[model samples]
Target: MRAFPAVAGNETLRNGLPGGLYSLLSHAEQYRLLCRRPDLIAPAVDELLRFWPPVVEFRRTATRDVVLAGKEIRGGDKVVVYHASANRDESVFPDPDRLDITRAPNDHVSFGFGAHFCVGARLARIQMSALIGRVVAELPGLELASDAPPKRLVSNFQNGLKELRIRWG
Candidate 1:
């Protein structure tokens, strides 16, 4: 119930990985892995969150009456933060549309800006990087097979490839 799908604009990890994406990690192991790789962690946690957003959209209530973006809102007003859209904000990420793997100091909002960040951020990165690294080391020129286009999930909420046909020596 915690994880969701990526969007059209959020395919960095998907395109970065080999054979498409693999699997999701449970909550317990997620924290354990992050704790292990303390040196290589970053807002890349943000990237994974962007790549595999937990919730398509989330709702929040205003703690106090306030006005936002030329709109007036009373206290307890409901607000929905689209994590996916926030991750692609041009103001936050220069050339937000581009998927640069080496993007450093990336403070993407996909994992929530503050304390609300995803719990499994660490494990997701370890698994993802491991897969990507394996492909690069084990199979150079690895690419999608030229038989048929990969299948789609048919749901925009979940941006995932149903299958990735690949061949490599």
Candidate 2:
């Protein structure tokens, strides 16, 4: 029997989409802004992607020996790249922790980078933008149903919420 390989591309929709939605909805101020200005949906989606990248981290083999942050890594050493950390790097993103929907030049690595960049990145962005746009238009009154913290998916590889309780009048 031939074992089927995991369809990693689905992660963009399965994990990424929901994660982005939850991040936006949970932040009431941001949600209201998007509802008021539909034109900001695209950038808002990008910010959401950066703020909570679904693929938390990925592993790759180093091609050459190098010293990173004082640690020497030999060729072929396994290196873990944490997308979440890179997205929030203060040097790259000013006031990184705060979500700025209008942030320009948002060179976030939520979709990976270089040769390993995700092919479905454009599709992911479009999907996020469309979904967010529709939500803003149709559910302007939507809000978190509870003040309790959301239940997050317990996986080091994926950053996502298990459920986001919401209500609309």
Candidate 3:
């Protein structure tokens, strides 16, 4: 880890691609992605979860009468926790509006918290990371294919870009 600082400080190495995987080696690399290096897999899935979280709103019913944030709730009353809102909570994240690649300790509740956590979380993370890694590697110099701006979805629940056209050599 100590070597990381010295390597990071070198400007020439900073901008260059390290040759672990290239677009040409994809067939073999892809097979390994399916079977090995699960550690790499988790972050990839987390990235997509950060990008497009599913199960937008989760509702929980109070076992008994309760009050939270000065709001009164009776037993069997359903309270919704909007994951999308919580994921972008400004109090928790600096510049919550931006997508940061290196944000650590990102305890976003996209997958729910505590006992309610998703069972497929591990699998989900692996698949997403592998998929994204492959796409980026294939399109190393990828860029927007169209000059036109994107058209966003009208629904509040979906955070998808309608179109993101791109082409690269």
Residues 1-169 of candidate 3 have per-residue lDDT tens digits of 3333232223211111111122112233432453344444344344335434554566798889988879999999988888778878888867776554445657778667887776556554554465556655455454444565444444444344444454565
**Model 1 RMSD to the real structure?**
9.2
> Model 1, 1-169: lDDT tens per residue?
6555343224534532422222112122332344343343343344455544544566778888888778998888898887668768787778766544435757765445565665555555666666644544455444445676666545544445556666553
For model 3, the run of ten residues with the poorest summed lDDT: 11-20
The 10-residue segment of model 1 with minimum total lDDT is 19-28
The TM-score obtained by model 1 is: 0.61
Candidate 2, 50-88: lDDT as tens digits:
998978898999999999989999999999999999999
Which number leads on lDDT? 2
Clash pairs detected, candidate 2? none
Look at candidate 3 and tell me the lDDT of residue 109. 80
Candidate 3 TM-score over all chains jointly: 0.62
List the candidate numbers ranked by lDDT, top first.
2, 1, 3
**Candidate 1 clash pair list:** none
Q: Could you tell me which residue pairs clash in candidate 3?
A: 44-129, 45-125, 145-166
